[model samples]
Target: MIKVEEAIAIIEANSTKMPVELISVHKALGYVLAEKVFSPINMPPFRQSAMDGYAFIHSIKHQYDVVGISQAGDHSNIKLKPNEAIRIFTGAFVPDAADTVVMQEHVMANKDSILIATMPPKLSNVRPKGEQIGKDEVVFEAGTLITPAAIGFLASLGITEIEVYKKPKVAVLVTGNELVKPGKNLKKGKIFESNSVMLEAALQTIGIKKTKVYRVKDNLKATKQALKSILKKFDIVLISGGISVGDYDFVKEALLQNNVKELFYKINQKPGKPMFFGSKNETLVFALPGNPASSLTNFYIYVSPAVKNKMGFSEIHKPKVVRKLNAAITNNTGKTLFLKARYDETNVTVLNGQSSAMLNTFAIANSLLIVPQDVEEYKKNQLVTLLPID
Candidate 1:
């Protein structure tokens, strides 16, 4: 078995970013940027009004004649004289020679002339050209995760479309003959299939929107056929169960028979020691443990980062926090362990029953306590690393 960090490094070194494609700014949300986006023109593009007011030269303080009215989209250029002002609405272009704007609330307006009750300062309520962004400025760097705010920023720069990395296709295979679909009557030794649904949701949350879930029985022929068929369709394949050395486990045998290159079989970790990863014809596959908590933990630690890296994200790790332990805990000395934990501002407390198959403790866990392989016990108030869910 290899260390978790070594396994993570192996997975990351082999992963490559996907090809880039042009997508509409509206559709680019949650996608990773493929290229650096530079501003072709200034953000405002021209001097514009920032408020509904009168645009005039600050030198002419008290009295001014209303020369023209400027509304949004009025391209007619009107230059202002020393004693002249333009009745401009918000977002309208500011006329030349007009360096100040007195809001209508402060200016007493008549039919043709306005009285300036408050002398506005220069450039007040006026958006100068290129004030927000300049031409050729780097608006967004490559490998950025485009969010709604980013989309708005790009739109402000008149970018209707942008290049972004394509979302990776994922195939989730839940293997177990004893597993039945939800809402079905459970027989003597059958349980409802929950891993598929859980993993599918988890993948979607990380921006891998294209996913397909399949149910495979524990037969050699069926498993082999399914693997062969899916290998050609998906960029990443996730197999739940059939990885441990059980009598019905056939995934390892099928993978080896199909000439799949095994990268690593297992890692020195608790709750997910039977995890396996390999590649077949450029398609990556992960065989996670059957237990629900173990499968999810392994997915977050290994598979999720691989997918994120392939999608062109620079950072693939989740947010972690440092907290002091509230109680003492002990574990095996040789294997790293991720125990379900609940943490707040003051302390982080481990949940009871660190078994891989248990779900009750995982339900209320907001974080995971990462215990390295060399440590056997932790005393109270010991500082530890906590991987937060969000």
Candidate 2:
């Protein structure tokens, strides 16, 4: 058995980054960059007008002649003389001779002539060339996550595609013979299979989409064969059952038979004490307990970070905070206790139906109240740390 923090550290040290691929920026959101991106051209490549105004050479005179008009996406290079101005719209290229812009609201216009009611500072409302970023400058460094705003900035720089770290290929191997697929008639002592779908959905939330699912019998031969095939192809493999030392449990033996080095077999935690972690070559494997709630709990607290780190994410852990407990609680299991709870800004309330096999209370929970192994009792309004799941 091991501590939860120790298990997380082991997984982190064993994880490695995946290979890189060149993908279109349109599809690069949530992906980490593999190479630094430099601006191909100066953003706002020309001196531009920041608003719909009159571009003119600065003068003490309160009147000017409008020589030409410049709308957005057009360059009216009409040179302005003293007291001469051009009608310029937002994002339009400003004439070279103009040194200032007077907003239309401050100007009284008569035909092509205008009277300036106010004098703005020189170069006011005129954006300088390369004001945003200069050409050949670093726009984003390696390891930056491509967010939607980053996409817009890249589009402004004319970046159609970028090199990014590839998402790891994952496989979910559910090991049990009595598991039945949904919509099937349930026989005596048989249960519906749900861990595969739940685990897959959990992976999708972290931007891992290339996942495959498989089922293996509870026997040793079937488990070994399944492990061998998945271990050979996937970067990360999640096995859903048979990790404990029950009569039909065979995941541990199968992993050893396939030459997988065990990193840790169990954690001193309630809900998921039978968890197993191992490695075969460059691939990482996690065997979560078959119970529904325990499987999901182990995935969030342990497997999610490993997968995120493999895809090049630096900050991958769930958000943790201290909140006052709404009710008193006691931990008598002599191990760490994980409970589903609801939390606001400063308080958390534990929900009912916390059994490992149940998921009803989990559906409404936004956080997990974690009680450490040594702490036996907690009074109402006592501060406890919680990991948010929503």
Candidate 3:
């Protein structure tokens, strides 16, 4: 067994970036850019009107002759002479020789001319050329995640396709004969399986869509055959259960037989001590503990970060902050304990059901309270590190 930090370090050293591919900007949301994206042309592209107003050369006179009108997406060829103004709407290109714009609300319109009710400042309500962005400027750097705002911004600059790291193909294998599907009749001692659904939803939340779930019975030969087939097909395989030293625990043996080099089998942590991580060539495998809460906790602490790193994210770890504890708690084990909790900006409350198998308290938890090894008790109001869940 090893400390949690050591296990995390081992994972970090092996998580490599995936290959890049060209994808449409429309489909690039939530994906990290593999290369820098530059603006093709100057944003706004020309001096534009910021409001529905009169475009004129700034002068001492409060009145001017109305020459023509300009609306959005229309280019004006009419040039404004001295004491002349153009009726320009928002987003319309400013006519040549016009340096100021007075909003329509501030001026009184006449048949052939408009009278300005108040003297407007020079270049008021006028957007200068390249005011938002210049041509060839780096709008998004490499490793930046493309969000909805990013999508709109890139589209405005005519970005049709972008280079992004491809997401990993994954297969989830849930092993245990005692596990029955949900909505079915419960047998003697069997329980409805929740780990597969929980793990699938967790993966989908992080933009990993290439996933499939399979269930294998608790036999060594069948488990080995299934493992051998899955190893040849997927880049990452997430197996839940059969990692401990029980008679039916065969995940470790199956992995070894298929040439998966064991990186670590157990970690010094509560709820997830039997978590297993290994690799075979480019394929990564995370054999999480059978308990629902333990599997989800391990996924957040280890698997999620690894997947994000492979997708070219610069910040792969979860958001951590120092927050005040609202209540007292104690850990009896020598290993570190991750307790589920509810938190606001300044404080966190450790919820009930800290057991490895219970998911009741986890459902409402928005953060994980970190209890370091060697610390047996924590008093209320004490500051501690917390990992926020998204």
- Segments in model 2 whose C-alpha atoms lie over 4 Å from true places: 58-62, 103-107, 116-123
Better of 1 and 3 by TM-score: 3
Measured against the true structure, the TM-scores of the candidates, in listed sequence, are 0.94, 0.92, 0.97
Each prediction's RMSD to truth: 1.9, 2.1, 1.3
Candidate 1: regions farther than 4 A off? none
User: For candidate 2, lDDT tens digit of each residue in 1-390?
Assistant: 999889989999999889999999999988999899999999889999988989999978989998999999897869789979989899999988997888999999977999999889888999999999999999999888888999999999999999999988999999888999999999999999999999999998888876899998899998998888889899999999999889999999999999999999999998999999999888999999999999999998999999988888878897798999999999998898889999998899999999999999999999889999999999999999998895
Question: On a 0 to 1 TM-score scale, where does candidate 1 land against the true structure?
Answer: 0.94
For residues 1-390, what per-residue lDDT tens digits would candidate 1 score against the true structure? Answer: 899999999899877788899999999988999999999999799899999999999974698899899999996488778899989999998887888899999988898999999887778998989998899999999999999999898988889999999988899988999999999999999998899888988898889776899888999899998988888898899999999999999998888887888999989999899988998766888999999999988988898899999899988998789999999878765899999999999799999977898878887898889999999998999999988873
Ranking by TM-score: 3, 1, 2
- Which lDDT value does model 1 have at 90? 92
Alpha-carbon deviation at 353 in model 2, angstroms = 1.8
| Residues forming the 10-long window of minimal summed lDDT in candidate 1 | 74-83
lDDT per model, in order? 0.89, 0.92, 0.92
